[model samples]
Target: ADVDYWSGCLAPDKLAARITPATQALVAANANGHPAAWNELRTLASQHGLLLIEDSSEAIGSTYRGRVVGSFGDCAILDFTQPGPLSCSQGALVLTDDIDLASKLRLLRNRRLSDRGSVVAGGLPVADAGIGELNAALGLAQWTRLDDILARRKAVEAHYLKVIQSFEGIKPPYVAPDVDEVHWFLSLVHLGTRFSRGSRDDIVDDLHTAGVEAAAYCLPLHRQARYFDNQRPSQDLWVTDKLADRALALPFHAHLDAEEVEFIVQTAKDASINVGAGSAIYL
Candidate 1:
């Protein structure tokens, strides 16, 4: 299938333009737990007779329009990677209320054909992709402690928001009014327009110098060498490109204390200023 990629969580006009006759489904990530874009996307999908697939991987505890994010789409997915809310090392969950869909998913996980199709009596003909017993146990344990985990993450988010508020050139991730909650996988900050991608890298370097790990949140996938296709028409992704350049991911976890957050914020502020001043360059 030829996948039509949108540049990040899309605006209504951009999404409408991308929906060709062959577009069967619309898949989107609930970026940083904000759902305004997703909500809009859902509306467009309904209008266009497309299945809306929500990738709520990083937004396990987030809500949009009083409904949980994962519940918004026809089907939704959650990745339980180390960085995700319900970490079980590595696994993923697909959720849907449709019984047929659920049954098909179960069969797929166990590498089994549909009951109507030719079946093997002893085992599946192919390798099973089912979650192991250990991973399932870990996921269950994490699910039981989800509330506590969410609370601690929210506390850390509060600390970062408080400290980041005073920094002039840094902007915290925006939460839409309809979003009742946010489960921050990592605290993201947008460096001011005055700063370039190089300056953002400098800030990351300075944070490492201070013993705090930081990184650029994401790079445009289409711009990456591995994914770049010269045969495809060169498309403008100005918004995504600008965001990729300015966004920085800061150290974030439920275990982070107030003091650690303070240090990180201070270091980031100092680094941005130093980089802007041109005094921090070593080479």
Candidate 2:
């Protein structure tokens, strides 16, 4: 089975413009990367009878080309784990317009019609045999608050960009021209050539020592342990690997205050300088 995921900007638009008639499906994930571009890709895919799978795991409140990301594909997936805007203890969901597919997904989760052929507890099942009613209830409640959560997270991301841009060696991650909103799972700053002197690691370690937890946003999916033996040629991911090394994400949450944001920025600036200076050697 061959799959294509959209992560790079130029490539997505290019792929959307041109594809072999043999291509099967086009999959897209990542928050607010570029849905219009993906839409074009989807239309092209449909022209050739290909499936579109949208991953809105990091894009719950994000929009693409004025439509929601989850609304565009044959099937969509959303993560409910920590780091998402509406995170919970566990669970992920798939959404689709097809009733048959929905029924199949329910069956996949182990839900089945009761053999007794009678409704129990006023149309509620006596035995779940799958996801429990309580889990559904919890998710429903969380869904109700998604708007507020996304709003707060967007605000936080905006403030971060505002402050980080003022410091040297920090620039917000790439957001395509067409994206109206960003559901930032992590706020990104490029370490750039400043990393050549080792500033990136110094900044990362400084944040850790200062009680501000931060990390590299992602590793190329092809580099994971399971894929190592069968990894695609390294040249396929020139940009992805570059991002993997030089991008750093700082502590980002709704609860953080302006003072905290300032501190994080200042600390990062110091660390970047230290890395550029090299080895902290005294003259």
Candidate 3:
């Protein structure tokens, strides 16, 4: 699950709490190519004797410490969703050096109910059609085009950064120093305390009215009614909570042209102005 940036009207800090060594299973957010954060998290997991599981669905081409994100943890999982480089329809992959975990996953995801031997062959079998042929074809095609796709996505993100950075009140997501490649899935703009003009909702609506689809990004998971009821929170997250309130995701795709990017930027700036001091805003 994704970490929530906000809870109870407060911004949560990006730093997770230091757990005792008794903790066994560790799950981490995939910060694209941010080596320091990853390094800190890796050390924490190592200290705790925990198996770090990275949700690398958003970091396909990102690197950490000169190694790719998928290689960072004990196990990493990737999703072939719409924004993913490997997307065709839907797919998931798990990567690990641990042979035991790999073998277990294979059996769990693709096991047959029918017995391997003659004595226990009475149960019904579960069959996956696409897992055999369609999945293989999709995988091969995506693998072949992975590099080119990543480059295209990077170009789009660079365009977004160039345009958005020129605007007065929007800050793009941070990219750490050592990240060699980032397979951008979304173009995020943070409206922090510095932005005096408008709220995130206002900006999102303004973009939408101009035919640019935009949205507030992640909500803090801790504040969700279902999750909060069951688990007591351990720390105060000042940064993440603020991010949940102010972060906006603009439309980004490899197919978008420079003209389109310009339009988005112009619209966003206009929206920011409109929302300042209640000038005018549909949202």
lDDT of each: 0.76, 0.66, 0.65
Off by over 4 Å in 2: 1-10, 13-23, 32-36, 113-135, 196-199, 277-283
Residue 63, model 3: lDDT of: 72
Name the candidate that leads on lDDT: 1
lDDT tens digits by residue: candidate 1, 1-283 = 1111222355667668778998999877777655536667778998999988888888888887778878977899888886667889867899999898787777677753454476556433443667889999999999999989989989999999888888775554566656677777778887777788998898899889989899998877667776665544335666777777888888888899999999999988888888875332211
lDDT of 2 by residue, 1-283 (tens): 1122223433555455545777777776654333435656677667778887787777777776687778877889887777777666567788999998777676566534574475334333333334456666777797998888777877787778778876664434565666776677776666655464245666788888887787766666777877788865566566666666677778877777778888887887776776664332211
- In the range 155-235, model 3's lDDT, one tens digit per residue, is 877788778777665444565555565666677666646443246787787788888898877667777888688985635
lDDT minimum window of 10 residues, candidate 2:
1-10
- Whose TM-score is higher: candidate 1's or candidate 2's? 1
lDDT of 2: 0.66
Which sequence of candidate numbers ranks them by lDDT, best first?
1, 2, 3
> Top TM-score: which candidate number?
1
Indicate the residue-level lDDT of 49 in model 2.
Answer: 88
Comparing 2 and 3 on lDDT, the stronger one? 2
Candidate 3 residues lying further than 4 Å off, grouped into runs, are: 1-16, 32-36, 113-136, 194-198, 277-283
